[model samples]
Target: MKTRIATAVLAAALLTACARDPQPASLPPAPSATSTATSTAVAEPCASVITRMSERERLAQLLVVGVDPADPDAAVRLVREQQVGGVFIGGNATALLRNNALDAVQHAARWGVSIAVDEEGGRVQRIDELDGTLPSARTMARTKTVDQVRAAGRERGAQLRARGVTVDFAPSLDVSSQPDDGPIGDRSFSSDPAVVRAYGLAFAAGLRDAGITPVFKHFPGHGHAEGDSHAGQVTTPALASLRTVDLVPYQDVAGFDGGAVMVGHLTVPGLTDGVPASLSPAAYRLLREDYHFTGPVLTDDLGAMKAITGTYRLPDAVLHALLAGADQALWSSGGNVSAVLDRLQQAVDSGELPATRVTDALGRILPAKHACG
Candidate 1:
């Protein structure tokens, strides 16, 4: 009986030892100071992927590519395959395209993607493919009071919201100092900077009223650039003159909560010795350090102009633009999307571009999105 008791005691001891030796625990690292605060925290895999990106992925995130809204696969590919952050809606102004556009936007959004469109009035309008397009900024500048412009903006924004577009690149703040400048002559609100400021603010307010966002473009002013920024290298001496005259409109929009500012691909000797504004750190500094414009900064289409296409490889230009200050690299063909991203990843891997800068820039873009929500 004592022998039996000894065996049972031994078994009991063994069970106690087993209970004391617990399996290894699996716990995540504690939140660190370097990590994003809980309030602005991004999703895990996405945030991790974004933070610990291979050069390929960083470039992909910087790009906002254009795609057909009708093709759900294209939109899904942009988000899932390419990991693109945004998609620019591209379709002719037609009933079919317009009718189907919103559905496409909803699909893209389901995958945590954002949608953008060029809803600038007149020749630049995209939403008008289904409804009637509004008159040019020049036409509006001639007859409209601030109230009238504001009212039109609200209505235009409503149309945009109904179509699933949240961002409108509008209110050409260029002063139209050069009457003969073909592309912007009709797009500018007025030759007077004060009038431009009033109209630009009203237009922005109108969009805000409808819970939509606006992107004011061609910073430091595109008014005096001698050629179309879309087609070729545009150079202008008035870039200096615009510091006070044409840029005044931007000064008014500068306080905009979530508005994005697009830098044009024009050469302004006063600001950038020879490099276009879109690729110039000096020009970007004027926005970031000098004026303290703390918002998402986008480059005018990297694929559109000869200035960009003729001089720098689209991928290299995209890297330079982001390194310089532009947050979102705009591209049209969607093909350049991958190449642009690859270059960015390469730059990050090479340590030529700091990851922190890219993160900060992307962070700036998020607020505008929140504003849209």
Candidate 2:
């Protein structure tokens, strides 16, 4: 009886650890970078494998290009040709989600490709048409207990994983009270940072339970931004004001395992100078240094968002995002795979973007991937 109790206690402890540290037991750590791998077993020693990859492959691994949901062949071709890290399955289309199209894309990669989606639920979900509905963050907070919210996330996550999704960009960590339909409005769990932290972590844990990596988004906080980056450049409150409220939920994520962060395009008065957070070195520095977040840092959409397009083209935006310290740059409009790779190669050849940075990005990326292939 004592042995049975001890065994149960140990199993519970390990499961708790698995949620915070996703690295598989069999994989070797990436050179000079910490491993952020999922707890699921993987066939390859991916971290060690990344060190031997080509310079261009290393750079390619830093991008998560968009894939049209209606067309699956394009995604497979893109990864086969460019050896890019992952493909973003965005928008409301259900064609790709309906079949095993993603499996073909996954097998096309020599390494592996991460299949990511924005499944935050309610106004922002990718698979609800086929799987079922999920309440918005506000509704989840107001109507359900934290445990219920976690269960909902787990159920939705399992559904997405079944559809070949490996990463979910969800559970907005922003603290806000804006109108329900505004940019962050109901997407945010609550205006209270503490509530955001509790509900956000609960949702994240649920996804982790289902073997889907949960990405805590709009880092440094997007809840209080003055405008929507989807339409135009947005600015946030000064760094000091952010530190108390908007930035509070982030404090819990630095140590969270099997997770990632999405940096928004908002410009902060005291931190970003005049650049959006997605393109600012200072903003990344704060996330890396001040917050001590070591997981994969991804840039929010740079292709369609006006804040990025208004200032730079796709190629230049990708370059800027890399130099700004993002592990991967997401462009969800779904084209320009070859053109963008060519541009990034040119930047590397000219020493505009250092080779070491590419390798460092790969170190974080390889370990963080859910290995859909």
Best by lDDT: 2
lDDT scores in order = 0.66, 0.78
- Model 2: weakest 10-residue lDDT segment is 28-37
Candidate 2 TM-score versus the reference: 0.86
82-148 per-residue lDDT for model 1 (tens digits): 7676677554523314555456445544224557776667666666646678877788878888899
lDDT of 1 at 34: 27
Tens-digit per-residue lDDT, 73-95, candidate 2: 77788889888888887766677
What TM-score would every model get versus the actual structure? 0.80, 0.86
lDDT of 2 at 189: 96
Q: Which stretches of candidate 1 lie over 4 Å from their true place?
A: 1-58, 69-72, 91-111, 177-181, 371-373
Q: Number of clashes in model 1?
A: 3
